[model samples]
Target: MFMQNLPSEVLINEVSTRDGFQSEAVFVPTDKKIEMIDRLSLLGLNKIEVTSFVSPKAIPNLRDAEEVMNRITRNPKVTYVALVPNEKGAERALATKADEVNLVMSVSESHNLSNMRMTCAQSLAQFRRICGLMEGSDVRINASLATSFGCPFEGIIAPERVIDVIDQYLEIGIQSISIADTTGMASPRQVYELCSLVRRIYPSVDVTLHLHNTRGMGLTNALAGLSAGINQLDASLGGIGGCPYAPGATGNICTEDLVHMLESIGLNTNVDLMKLLEISRELPAMLEHETSGQVAKAGLRTETRPLSQNVIDLKNRNEKH
Candidate 1:
């Protein structure tokens, strides 16, 4: 299906700080990261991936994770999550009192080694250690399976490969799982089948879709995921972020654009579109380069504009739906 009768409310987890910044060449000041997170907190965001607890050597841009976490004013309603690679990183995240710890591993062995410098089996071994560290803790644990749809090195990934990792995640007591289209190669049919299959078997688990717009189908794929009963979605502000190791990887689905699409379709995202647009507008000046977001460049549907025949036709068609 091209469109879906979307849920009344959907959870959008902002990952700009964590995933978005890791690829930048310039180091964004800790104050700036805190400022953005604090502002996002007040905007009624469901969750925000604050920072990654990785080594400064891995992603030097986010070296100040501790300072960013400490500087941001915590909002109880908003979940503050941090990415951790292993037990050591999880320990640091726990020290900062992060509300959640997000672990990542690619489903493809080649992609895993390329991006994470570890084989898939080795990555899982490390994840098991991290899981042991989080045992008997209040901190929420989530696993984001990267390259779930397709990999640059490996052409197509089997859904069974993703399901095996998800089963392992569940065994470790991780309830939330994000299947990311690491290189933006997912088709709508592939999205539908994967989400439907995951939900059909793992009825109790919370599945989220983390998609990218590298191929310009992020919103379309998101609609397909929702059509299959996956309500949680991950997006990056200003469409920033790509894997430094994954070949041909690019920024994630733009957060404001996704929200605009959902809101236009009468789904409740609970995000302030005007405020998000304002944020997207400032990013280009802040980053010293044009961002990948298009909504700010193009006015939203509700904006003041002369309606054309094409616009009228679309409106009439949607009304009939």
Candidate 2:
């Protein structure tokens, strides 16, 4: 059934430059990165994940994180968040005047060990230490639980395991939490059940969903999230950013595609679809790779002369179904 009663407004946090470029082989120049952010801002995005402040040895692509942070023409209305893995990374992010600092640790024990080289308990303790270090800083903390849905090394993650990790972040006084499908192992049922549970547990916390399209279920999972009362979503232009560990994994859901889907369904994202499409068009050339965005490849419906009989029939059949 169509969701006519769904809330009209939803927030889309653009993560193209940071999460999108983390896996890119070539380093996008600081100037180009700034240009991309600037353009994205013009498209009416309310938030943007600028870059991560991790060690240069870990993510060489963002070695110029400071440069990218310093160069962008930041919009006063838009919130720019930087991902900081540890206290040192948080310090680097704070120095850049980032509006928010996002901290994340994997929920699965094996994944946590592999990703952060720390146990779940140890990671929570580290986050508590980082929170203490903030000490009246303007930067807000948003703790993300990566692999909240499922893990590659360890198959299914228990719902209680996710809640246990979230409890730690909340106990440390983190107000915002971003639940990430780091390896894109989430399904619609999983998203609905888990998101509802999280919302129930943390009623006042600002929860955001960072979905991945690796299994072609990104949009479906997003709708499930929306039904579960999640309004904030993290998406990348051209569906960028794939897991380095997960073989055959795809990128995050495409920002333009998500926006298009939402708008088509009468949801307001405040994002200009045409301008977003322009950004997606330039992305492949900027990154020098073929993107998988259908809207980008086929163009928007408005660009066509008119709906052909076959297309109209397909739409009719879809509506009838």
Candidate 3:
């Protein structure tokens, strides 16, 4: 019955260029960012978070947000998204012609303070102001509820707190929301409960699950979300992203791995797995470090290799016996 209720198709929103690159200490060159994004455009991603429009001093790695957004080759089938923190960011995102502007706030007060350097109420007010600024624009708004599952500083957040945040988001007229496990501390049962509650109460809003592999529960939590009727998910190439403000937090769920799992389970992500693997392979050389993605390190499940000499000899001996 659980399998029967699962959606046939899922929408994968790639966040490598924005979320993945933002956490790097060394700046990823703007041209390389553009090249990678252009390459990703051809792949069948439902959306690509191209960049974040924030103060350069805050996140210097993504300082070239404007130029990257302006230069990327747009794919009509893909919705280009930009993360915006305030009115200024909304202006910049609008100028870059982003298809959607993602607004972020934490359901946990401590996380909101640590991440955004403000209280929860302040962030909500800021979001309202940004929404007002975007009132006349054609671009859409998506509220990202950080620490929806759990918070590094404050510990487990209550489901009622999360629902209240969603209530405020709806009140502010933001219909799309992303429920993020900022530190990846959620259990599978917790994920199902919260996601089920959200789906049951607010049946109209578009919800996207943003998970991390901090404690290696990312994929399991995602499966739980799917069981709760969630079809939109956020993943990063090579699994490269985490909250800079959250201590001990790790990267997001690998895009290639997620696509591979979904496809293996007879669900559709509509992503080009081979092409995604090619891109994932390039991350190590490009970033000058090892990435956390598993499928990229190991071959796909259906892949095969010829028998080794030792295995061949063992087989012959066994046959003779």
Candidate 4:
């Protein structure tokens, strides 16, 4: 029998425009970014991380955050999200009227220092100030904990420390949490344990699982999260995204592949799988590089091809004999 705790429908958050594009060395033109986001909006994603409101020096590719955010046509059914690292980013995100601002930091001290140039405590303090800035506004705050499973510099993050960080985020009045496998070192058991703990301890908070395919366990870990009662997942189109600060890390789990698997397993994601595949197929041309997605290259499991002439001739000869 199937697990009773598994959710019937999972919520997919598309992050190509923010997390995916940030890792590219080549700057994706502002118009292209806006157009891609507009196309993604119609694919039935629950939320789309539109862009990051960061300094151009830090992430030059997303320097056009404001312009992209302003130009993209809003979908009433979709929540537009923006990555905000500090008060300045929060201000920029708010100015663009983003529905939600994702604040990120690392659970590992070494990773946090390398990625944000600040300790976890400093990141929390900055988040507090950002919270104060968003007070009374309609915008929502979501704290994303990077390197939650394992750190490249510091292997094996303790579960207690992750819970402690979540406690601090809750105290700061942030209701949503995103548990990220920054380097994709998370095992299925590790994902299940932490996600189950979070679910049991904090039943009221919203949780999103952001996984990477670096170690080839992204989809497995996602399944573990779902079995642990997590319904929200973050995926990138064409499976393109990784942390620049995390050495040897690869792209995220492919959005089309994940959606295809979910739907195949009798779980509902509400996303248009065909449209998603179409978008995934276009990524290679847009990025000028091949993508990591599988379903896009090898169509859906049900999609079949007709017999070739050679096969037909062989079959006819065998039947004639």
Candidate 5:
């Protein structure tokens, strides 16, 4: 029997444009990026983290945030989200009419400094300021806790610390929260426990899982989160992303593969695998290197396995003999 607690359908929030592109060494042209976002909007992703309004020096790949936002065809069905590092970023995102504003901080103090060059408290202050800037607007606010499971600077994080960050987000009137396995140090048990703990403490808040595949456990951790009654998940097309500041951190979970995995198990992510694969197939050319995703190489779940050529050759030899 299907687990009653498991959500039958989950929302896949594609963060390729923001999270994925931020790490790319090459700056994808503004027009191409906008075109990609437009196509993604129509392809049934529930939300798209479209771009980050960070300083050009910080993430030069996404420097054309305003042009990309202004040019993309907006689909009412898809929520367009932008990452904001501070109140100024929030203001820029609002001016471009982003549907939601996302802010991130690390639970690990050392990680926070390395990644954002700020203490956890200072990051919270920035989030608060962004909240104030976005107040009275229809734009929703979401808080992301990077290094939720483990930190490279520090080892395993206590669950209480994650809760502490959420408490502040809740107090600031941000109901949507994402717990990220930034370094992919999360085990399934830890993920399950964290999701359950957060659910128990703040049942009403929406939780999304943003996980990296640094240790090749992103999908497993996602499953754990789902088993614990969480739904939304963040993914990047072709699994392209990594923290520039955090050493050893790597690309995110592959979008097509994640959807393929969940859907094969009777869960719904509301994403079209074929359409998503079309996007994934282009990543190698787009980035000038092959991607980290496996589905593109392994084919879809519904496809029949390719027959063994050696077996066919052996049968032909026997027939000739």
Candidate 6:
């Protein structure tokens, strides 16, 4: 039986424009990037993380961040956000007039050291600094806790650790925060427990789940998150994202596939599954990697139609039966 009386609507934030391309060895042209995001915005997605404001030296692929942000026709319905690593990055994001800035820090000490070259405390310090920088601007801040479920370096992060990180961000005054399975190490049970705890601890804060499909548990965890009362989800079109620091970590949950599941279950995401599939088809050629999304490979259930009698007879005759 379908789960009934659940929240009817969900908010899916598309992140392909930034997270999907950042790990690629090849650079996706700025024009193509702009085109992709523009198409996605029209697919009824209300939030799209467009680019990052890190030093060009750190992420050369997104060095054209400003141009991409300015060139794309901003949609009033969609909020365009940028990832900012530190105070300087937040400053850059503000300059681009980003609707919101997402800041992240790793929960594992080892992953934190390897990825950001900073300790957990130091990373939170950076987040504090970023909050200070955005003192009086229209730009909103979202604190994302990377590897909140399990880290590559440190397996199975404690729930207390996750709550502590959330508390720190909340104390710093970020009303909206995202918990990311950065390395795709989350399980369904983890999603249920963590999301439940998050809701209990900070009932008012807007909590979004950023799930990765690296371990093949993306959809299951998403269900668990929903069971735990999460309405906001982060996904990438074509499932094209990878963690730069976590080896063998694949892309995120595909946007089209996620929408398909939600719609089938009588839940609403306000996204067009067909249009999202069209966008997914463009990823392989653009990124030079075949996507792992099932929807991209096998079209939606209704997309398939039975063959005509004539065609079936022709096929039978060709078989020499």
Q: Which candidate is the best by TM-score?
A: 4
lDDT against the true structure, per candidate, is: 0.88, 0.89, 0.92, 0.92, 0.89, 0.87
Candidate 6 per-residue lDDT, tens place, 179-206, comes to 9998889988898889989988889999
TM-score of each: 0.91, 0.93, 0.95, 0.96, 0.93, 0.93
Across 216-303, the per-residue lDDT of candidate 3 in tens digits comes to: 8998888999999899999999899865666545689999999999999999998999999999999988888888899999989999
Extract clashing residue pairs from model 2: none
- lDDT string, candidate 1, 14-47, tens digits: 9998888888867888888888899999877889
Count: clashes, candidate 6: 0
- Each prediction's RMSD over C-alphas, in Å, is 5.6, 5.0, 1.8, 1.6, 2.6, 3.0
- Model 3 — which ten-residue stretch has the worst lDDT? 242-251
Error of 5 at 142 (Å): 0.5
Tens-place lDDT digits, model 5, residues 1-321: 334477899899999998898988788999889989998998889899999999998889989999998889999999899998888899999999999988989999999998899998899888888888888899999889999999987999999999998998888788999999987899988999999999899999989999888888888888888989899999999888975666545589889889999998899877888999998899888878778889988888689976699998999999999
State the TM-score for model 1.
0.91
- Which window of ten consecutive residues has the lowest lDDT sum in model 2? 1-10
Please, what are the lDDT tens digits per residue for candidate 2 over residues 1-321?
A: 545335679999999899989889789988889888988877789799999999989999999999888889989989999999898998898789999988989999899999899998888888998898786998888989999999989987888999988887878898899999988899899998899999888889999999999899999999999888889999999998976766556789999899989987879999998998988898878888877677988877557577899999999999999
For candidate 3, the lDDT comes to 0.92
Candidate 4 residue pairs in clash (backbone atoms < 3 Å)? none
lDDT of 4 by residue, 1-321 (tens): 345578999999999888899988678999989888999999999999999999999899999999999999999999999999889999999899999999999999999999899999899999999999999999999999999999999998889989999999999999999999988889999999999999999999999999999988999899999999999999999889865655545688889999999998899999999998988898888888888899999999999999999999999999999
Q: Between candidates 2 and 4, which one is better according to lDDT? A: 4
